[model samples]
Structures are given as structure tokens and as C-alpha cells.
Target: MKVGFDGKRATQNITGLGNYSRYLIRLLTKFHPHNQFLIYAITIPPPELAISEVEYRYPGKQLIKSYWRSFGIIKNLLRDNIDLFHGLSNEIPYSLKTAGIPTVVTIHDLIFIRYPQYYSFIDRLIYKYKYRYAALHADKVIAISKQTKQDLMHYFGVNEDKIEVIYQDCDVIFHQQVTSLMKDEIKKKYQLPEKYLLNVGTIEERKNLMLIAKALLRIDNIHLVVVGRETKYTLTVKQFIKQNQLSERVHFLHNVAHCDLPAIYQHAELLIYPSRFEGFGIPIVEALHSGIPVIAAKGSCLEEAGGPGSIYIDPDDDVELAKQVKGIIDNNETKMKMVRMGKQYLDNFKSKLISDQTIHLYQNVIDNAKR
Candidate 1:
């Protein structure tokens, strides 16, 4: 099979959608080397990711480059004779269907629609247009979680049959064991507390990080280690931390190298993700893969990502959140049980399994297109 991907995020982004794109490409290439893979992007991809098994293509002229991703890229797809083009993000080129190519798009989340206050009016309008168009027009839609699939059906009225729920795995590095020495070194380098609760993701309102900060007021000596890109919402989190006099207990680490994350996870007491919504919570899987217990918010697909053994609490209830944290921290037996169950739950999200399922989906889409 000759497969092409919308490699903008894979090549340009270092996290989130970019991670997803790279993971899919790397796994498919590793497990299915016989198939040809093409990565299409407007910019030149990072040198390390331009592997021999995959070919990279981009626009040459300025005019074509300006509209390449949405309109101009169709000619390139046709010229390359791509058997199938998968948009790793939420959009496929509007012209792909007209050009007779089967398209598959991965819709990570419909958070902007579900929680409109987190996004500006213009952003919501743009997302709704692009996401709706791609979901409606693509030959198949891949929702990262069942919650996202339901959102697609509700907001865009996409048929349930059109959407496939394929769970995403965290970075393969998380699955590897980190040495105690490495964990110690990372803790020292980052100035992380000896015992801390870990939270990973962008510090945004939608992430509900302030809930954790508020919960910290009730707990003693246990710090919260936050790792992710910071935004304007971070200012709000910081203000709350200062107002509550939690300056000594909250640590924020930004742009930490990807190689260092497993050690950070290994050293932490547990993972607390209070995000109000997610397509699928990769951090939950990352923490689980590290054999740490997890406490995530109740309202989204986090349960699917965190699995059955993980604890879920209301996003707004800091008291209950604090109780859960203290319980996990104080009770060794419960902590160990959660860790064991988390490891078992992570089996379903193995890279090989996800890659195989994706391959099967590709074949099904291709075969159906032929008829």
C-alpha cells in the first residue's frame, strides 16, 4: 500500500498532534516496512524524522505554498499516486475527494465546541468550519476517543458508521524503565520535590489545573509538578498559586526534554489530571506505563485513557481530589494495586496493537474505495 500523510504537525510540532503524527508514521514504518509512506508538509521536516522508509514532499512555488495545505496539495497527491491520504490532524484537503483520493482524518477532540468559552469566537468558527468539512467529506473519520466520536455525531451530524474510535498511545520512551539514578538526577535538575503529584499537559483553563492548585491548599508537603507549554491561562494559575500562598509547593517546568519525562514520571508519587475534556488523555497512559497510580477528572474520555483501575473524581471538587491524593499517598497497598492494574490496562494500547489496527483500517478503506 502507498500511504500519504498530512505531515504538517508531524514535521513541525513537537507535542500533541505532532506526537500523534510521528508515532503513527514511526510505528507503521517499523511494523509494515513493505508499504510505501509519503509525508506531505509545507515546511521541510526535521532531519531526524526524514527516515529512509518515508518520502517527504512539499510545495516549491510561493503561490502554491500559500494555499498548498488546503487546495494546492491535491495535485501533488494525484501526481504521487497516493493510494490513501490520512490527515493526522483534524482536517483533510477540501479537494482530495474531488481528485478521487480516499481520505481519512484523525479528529483529536471537539473541545472547542464542547467548551466554547476556552476558545474565542473566531477560533471556534474556524475550527467548526474546517472540522465539520473534513469530518463530513473524508472517506473515513478516526476519532481518537469514543467521546470525541459522540461529539462529532452530535455537532456535525456525522454518521456513526463513518467514525472509527482508535485510541492513541503515549511516547514509546515512557514504556521503558528509568534507572533510579536517572530519576534522582532529573529530580535534582528540575528542582522537583522529593514527593510530588505530577500533572502533564498545557496549563490552560480547559485543563482545569487550578483545581489541582486549590487542592494543594489542603495537603501538606506534597508538591505539584506541572510540565507542559504555558499559555495566558498560566498567568491565572500563577495568580491563584500566589493568592493561596502555594509558591513553595507548586513547580512549573517548561520545555523539558522529551528524553527526561520517563524519569520524571518514575519519581512522582502519582499523576493528577484534572482536565475537563480530552480526545484521549495520553498523559494518563504515560503515567500508567510508568507504573504510577492516576487520579483524573471524571467528565471526558479520561476513563478510557486511564483505564478501569484508575480513580476518577469530579473536576470541580478539590476536597474530594485532595482526599483521593492523600489516600493514594498514605496507603501503600492501594497505591500498589492501582499501579498493578494500570500496567495491565496499558496492554491494550501497545504500539504494535494500535499500528496493526490502523493497518487493518487502511486496508478496509482502500478495499471499499475500489468498489
Candidate 2:
């Protein structure tokens, strides 16, 4: 059967959801190698020729194209002899009903429900209509975490069985072994010291990067290396570092290639994640699989991802975080202990394992529709 997928986020969003789209599509291509899948995307000024394959398809483009893709586009999808459609991010046309096609949407998180102020007025408006509505209407919903699934059930009042919990897999490159020499090579390349901590992701208020800076300021002979694009919120962190005279110690790495990340992970003495919230914590798995010890905030998804042996701290308590950072750095025995625990947790999230399960879920969704 020919499958239709939303590829709009592929070109638009560069961060979380876009990565999710790109990676999920890649996995689908591998596991369901024989099945024909068409990727549906919106473009301004349609391509002269449409690209078609078992993996992806670019149907049309532009405002007229979007309108057509939503309404008139169904005619083309029907013409393609498609059997089912899956909306990866959100905001399905709603017109899919017109074509008698079943639609599936994956709900990543519902931070908006708890902290609506974090979102702009228009963002909240769009989420209510495009995302929340799609979750309620879709034939099936894929939640990235059990926490997210629970959020969907309580806030949107959806059936539990309609939503499936599918934790995302780590990057294919992140593994439990990079040689000592390789770690040294990255150190030399980046001018990194032997003992330093690593933390990655957006530098925003919700991410609580300020807490990380506070934690690092108290620890002696240790530096924090941050990797991610700079945003307006980073100004506070930059200003804090300067005021505290830690400009020399705290380093900011903006826009590093994903390929070179494993070395950085290996270079770290430990990986610290103090995010106030998340749908799922990817870095914990990356650090665990990279054989690096993870230190993160308590009472969040980090606890679930880190399991045991990870150093958990109250994110708001700078004094406790400092104490943990010092203890973790000073003790080699502690680091080795956490590394062993992480290895066991890494097995369940192996890409091949989760990808196969996802494929099975897709097949189940298709099979149930027939009945």
C-alpha cells in the first residue's frame, strides 16, 4: 500500500520537530524497505518535475498549493492510490476525511497546558486549533513519552489506547566507546582542558541554562562547554558569565556539526542537563551510550531517562548542584559506577529496536483500519 507522510517540517523547522521528521522518515525507509511511501510537502512555486520514490514524494508548493494540498490536493493523493496518511508534526488538512484516508499524528508535548505564558498569543491560538484539534481527530496519536501520553489523555480527553508511547532513539553515531586518543584529539582541536563538563540544547529560560552556569561557577578546576545556536535568551547567560568573571572558564560552542559531537561527548568529564522541562531527554541517552556520566535535575524526564547512578539535583538549589558537581569531578569511582548503569539502559533505545517497534505499530494501525 502507498503511504502518505507530511514532510513540511523537514524544510521549515531546523530544531526539535524538524530533526524528529528527518530522523523518523529515515527510520521508516529502512525498516519498511519494501513499502511505497510518498512524502507530502508544501513549496512556493511548484517544482517543474515531481520526485517520486518508495521513500519520499514532493506533491506540490505555495499558498495556492497549500490550499490545494489541504482541499484540492486530496484529488492528487487519491490519484496516487494512497492507502493511509500520517502527519508527523501536526496540523493535518482536516480535508483528509474527504478522501476516506486515515490520519495519524504524533503529539510531542503539552508544555502549553501548564505554562501557557511561555507561548506567544498566536502560538497558543494555533496550537489550540491546528495541534490540539488534530490530536482529537486523528485516527491514532504517537506520544514521544509516557508523560506526554498522560498529558494528552488528561488535557485533550483522548482515549488511552488511541495514543501509543514511542520514545525517540538517540543519534545513530552516539555509542558507548570513543577511544582516549580520540577524546584527546578533540581536546587539542577545540583547546579543551582534560576536565570539563558538557551540556547541549537551547539556551532559554525554560532550559534553565542559568542554573548550569551557577553550578559551574562554584566548582573548581572545571569548565562548562555549551553547544547550540545562540538565542535572545542567551544574553542573560552571557551577561551572567561576564559579571561573575567566568568568561575565561565557561566556553560557548555555537553551531557544531552533528558528526563531531561524539568526540565532544567523550571529551566531557560529565554531561549536565538542568532543563526545567522536556517531552524527552535525548542527551542523557547520548551521554549514557557515550559512556559519560550524566548529572541532571530531579523531578523531570531526566529521572526517567537517567535511571540509577546518575547524579540528580534540585535544579533550583545552586548550592546542591555545586556540591554534586564537585563530588562527581573529584571521584573517579563514582563516574565509573554511573557509566556501567547507563550501558544497561541504552539497550532498550537502540535505533533498530525502537524503529522495528514503530514499524509494527504502523502495521497495527493499518490492520485495525481494515476491520
Query: Model 2 compared with the native: what TM-score?
Result: 0.91
lDDT scores in order: 0.91, 0.77
Model 2 lDDT, residue 87, Cα: 81
Collision count for each candidate, in order: 0, 4
lDDT tens digits, residue span 1-371, model 2: 56787777765666688777767776777777687777777742123222333344445544476675556657767888877787888667677765677778888888876678788988888787777888887888898888888888998898998898887877677864677887777777777766788988877777788998887777888888988777788999999999999898888886676767899998788898988778888888888878889888876567767777788888798888888877777888887888988888777676777778777777777787778
**Model 1 ranges off by over 4 Å:** none
Q: Candidate 1 lDDT (Cα, whole model)?
A: 0.91
For candidate 2, the clash count comes to 4
lDDT accuracy of residue 253 in candidate 2: 82
